[model samples]
Target: MDEKLIQRLESAIARLESLSPGSKPPSGTLDAVSAASEPSIVAYDDLLVEYVVKVSLAAEKIGGQVHDITIVLSQAFATQKELLMKIKQTQKPDGGGMTEFLKPLNDKLAQANNMSEGKRSDFFNHLKAASESLSALIWIAYTGKGCGKQKLLLLTSYFPIFNINLASKQQLFALIFSGMSMPIGHVEECWQSAEFYNNKVLVEYKNKDPYHVEWAKALKELYVPGLRDYVKAHYPLGPLWSTTGAVVSAPKSAQPSAPNPPSASLANLASSSSSRPKQGQGMAAVFQEISSKPVTSGLRKVTDDMKTKNRKDRAGFVSSGENEVQKSAPKTAAKTGPPKLELVMGRKWVVENQIGVKDLLIDDCDPKQTVYIFGCKDSVLQIKGKVNNITVDKCTKMGVLFTDVVAAFETVNCSSIEVQCQGAAPTISIDNTAGCQLYLSRESLETSITTAKATEVNVMVPSSDPDADLAEHPLPQQYIHTYQDGNFVTNPVSHSGG
Candidate 1:
């Protein structure tokens, strides 16, 4: 009756119209079916099986069988939609020509609505029969031959209990487009002539053989209560659950409440009075003298200090070596070398040199080399003499013997050194005790200066902590060139492994 409902009716009818003569089938039906039959379909079949399992699980959770309830529920939704469309499209004196066309449909819809629930169920059963006919028609359309009786039976067995009227493309579309304006007879005629399916194919209406007594019993159990108690007990949705809509309830039990404790002062006095002995004060005297007092802050301080020490000991940071990296330096580089750099690919790299200007070049590499470099921590190492294919691990050890080296790819092993730049200016300066001050262009340096002479004995230092004084004490010069193991025509020879 409302505009929105009317629009839905109109849309449904239009959809039905399109489905009138011939409409498109489900987009991937053929592919899905073909793929289902192939050996390779196992992979996709796994996905389908998973969904089917989930469907069964959901049905079990709701106390119903997946194949049964879905049919009735879907039917209910379709019937509701049809009733709505009919109500909206009901013709009036002022209604337009479209309304006149919708008049007969309104009467049929009213009749369908007035039918008893059992009658509706019968109608749905009829719709299901029609749907099977349609399915066979489609098979014939695709294969140009009528499906056999056994094939029809197999198809029927596989078909889940879905409401054909609710699920049908033509019916749903008609509900939307014509607003129940078209007569039911016309709708039936459209489906009859549609080439969508081959009616010549045999049809099967039952999941089980009709002659089976148990099959009839199961069918009866679906709608009846009490008579099928044994069957209902085994069914997931339980026979009684659907028919009687009854839920099991447990007997209620009263819980007792705990008695409240006496106030703190009263409890304390009572404890003192009860504990009075020959060596202690009398109970009456202790009770008379008792008075409330606040806890002192000094006691709390002692307790807090004890807790702090306990935590410190538990964490292992109380030991000197465990917290070595966090200690302050004496403003002097270790005789060994600066801390090593961990190169992690994908993360940004900051490589700069102190003392003098040096050129460093980098290039994209092949898959193997890319993996080796990118897998590195912090930043990748540069192998000496190898353009882009060498491993830094094979070129050099963590030592700074050269001083004049400008640039060379060399392998070095060292740990990282952390310094805090305490409230100092952002710019950093590299200075040497040997009377030479190096101005680095950037905060960090990354290079393999193997060919040029070593400039400094310092390299492999981490960025200063946000509060450290890196500007005051400059980094030492690191070995820029490699101490070649032997004379070779080429600087870098490929090594199989690091």
Candidate 2:
């Protein structure tokens, strides 16, 4: 066992005792996750090398960032590999969690509690960008393609699968901690007990889930091969990929052979594994569920509430305009303001009314479908949802609160912009922010920013390993150039609907 690593893991757990809710560390804690380089990778055998390189190249074709897989994702697999090897020796699982998985993100958010909306938004945007940029890479990894050679390397020490004791449990822990949500289905292999149903997180495992526990063959057979198939179909590239030898020069030892596409031979892998999920049976995503829908009752209810609010908010927004506030910026503040909204979830939610009075804490908001919030000022605001076109109107003394969100929450016109998302891509337009704080996420949107406003744009990735950048991050920012209409945006915000 690597005693130092164990000690570090133990110490990280120890710090949780003093940890409180919403606690965050000082600045520079979160490095630009997307911008982070790959971890120190051990070279792979030739066959694996060629295939992995092809996989990496395929990722670029699919619009996924290849480096994220090489850097963030490859490291995740490496970490899992190292931990699993230790587990096999002891034949026991390590324990400790929640904070173990989430503390890095939580700690930072807590620290920024007092930041003004502008400052908070800047921070949040960066975090969101890093997380989002890593999405596809993560999904590819989750499928177990990344786990292959590591498993092979450990078993034979020669890089071929034999006498393998798969690390399903450890992999699950790694996946969840990597910001992938827990699937509601039973884990056939190894799982202690952690559920993420809606925003209400539920995690309960004694000593946290262990790092070194190997799963049984029966269960492993049921899971691994199917996952390999999924990886073959979707990502096809490698957490293990290396480029062609002749094209790129490396020390002869590290040089890759000619790259060949994934061959048909890999398709039959599950043959020996035993009753895997048949195509429609959804076994392909053995470790995790394929559907993006919420599985648990708790998650469903939360999604329901979000949709319900969207309906109401959409209604209100379509019906009313902040007629009192003129389109043109006023030299002097208006004495009279628009009608006040109830300013709570469900009742006055959907953010159509005067937003200056109340803070916005919303979740599951669909950016493509509705215009959620616009033109608010001088209030603490926190909105959580999938990334979509957001038109943030002007606000003085504005404050935006950012919690760790699953998707991108790109804003259009907020004076101060900060976004932090896990597995989300966030973009900010320079059309509005000038001399305003703009900490856009690491993989920010494409629109040009002419201003040199002390905008604080940086990617804040939440990882115990400062270098860990996620692969399955967010999508690109949708920039529709049309101007805002009123309390509602006039531009069509649809992206994937096409």
Candidate 3:
């Protein structure tokens, strides 16, 4: 086991123990205690109801903040025309300029002192951060600069909340349904703006500097996950009729009836019956009636209806005549093969599911095109010309030789992958990968390489002397990060060579 993981588990156990009852009572004594004195165990249905109510209330509060942030973003876009124009005119990717441009928007956000405090403060802060991310993304897509840190901030800050494995469903749903609902229009507009930038501005600089395309691509990636979450959270409500069901009634004889005088005149009997309590008129009967009906919600009804429809469809298909089933089976069984290497929209090259193929090549790639290699095993791919970016994903024992990448060369979720770059690549990123070997030619020696959750990464660079062997540098896999003076400072583990 990893030492860090062991420490984390130990810490979690300590916390749990601290929160547990101080000492366990004798086993028999617990059962002997009076049930009335013991704390009531909340039912799952009651807890779920409480949680839903709390989430709904929180959503409303957060929705207001989101609405305010949307207005701020819109105002910034409209009033800061001069700054935007300056951003367009600027040729360099200056992080400082981007910060300055965002100051006004941040100031407006800071003035929202009406926001409540405490744990809710964290939610408001996240809302502000998300707004800033969205605004920065739009600006980056518009100006085609500030692609480095701003894009990284957006990915790191907001993207993880959308991960189902990392966040609770309620949390994810609340954030998407509340924080993003109001700003969805703006998000769409930003997407359109990015597409326009990709088609118009980046196309002109296809040969000289196509790295600006990364901003557009990053914006698109950010938008897609949030959009997916939005769809999940905003599923249509079930019809009201679906929640309605026949109420179960008690038997007629079992119901309580009014008392009648046994030996009295007819008029006296009527008077006595009128004064007595009638059947099913008291609170107990009302309670009984309420308990007899099944509890359900519209959402649950819709989900159940959908499941029933699916089961019925399957049953109908299974019960079909043999000839009819055989005739329809061919259509269901026939499936297309996984996609091969192809260019999409004249901008992206998708290569997928090629196994044990050695001769894969993209000889005529332009600087505006991005290459995506996915699920290729024991394959060697060669790109003969410059491309905007390249991503190698989920591959094993794959070798990639590329001439140049104007933006970034990224490898994600792969093992035993080797990449060689003969020309310049501004950035090379390895993520969730293992056993990566990167060979950088003299012309590409200045490339910036970044890695996260990766191991066994070695970079080979040509030595100063032409006759000397290439110098191999292994990237540090372990690091220590400490909070100091407000920010975290990270340092790689020390070795004897240092």
TM-score of 2: 0.22
Candidate with the larger lDDT of 1 and 2: 2
lDDT of each: 0.29, 0.33, 0.55
Candidate RMSDs in order: 31.9, 27.8, 26.8
* Model 1: per-residue Cα lDDT over 227-295, one tens digit each: 122122322221111222222222233223587977678788987776554445567555554433244
Provide the lowest-lDDT 10-residue window in model 1.
136-145
lDDT of 3 at 34: 21
lDDT (10s digit) by residue, model 3, range 1-498 = 265346446545654554468956553333223211212211212322333233333334435554454344334433333333233223333334334444554454333322322222212333433343343323222222223344333232323434422212343344333432223443554454334323322333345433433322332444444332332243212001112322222345644589984778989889777655567589776676556766662234356656756666656445657999899777744532364999888888988878888999999789878888887889999999998878888899999999988877888789999999999987788877999999999999888786867899999999999999999999999999999999989999877975
Candidate 2: segments with Cα more than 4 A from true spot: 1-336, 339-358, 401-414, 435-498
Better of 1 and 2 by TM-score: 2
**TM-score of every model?**
0.14, 0.22, 0.38
Output the better candidate (1/3) by TM-score: 3
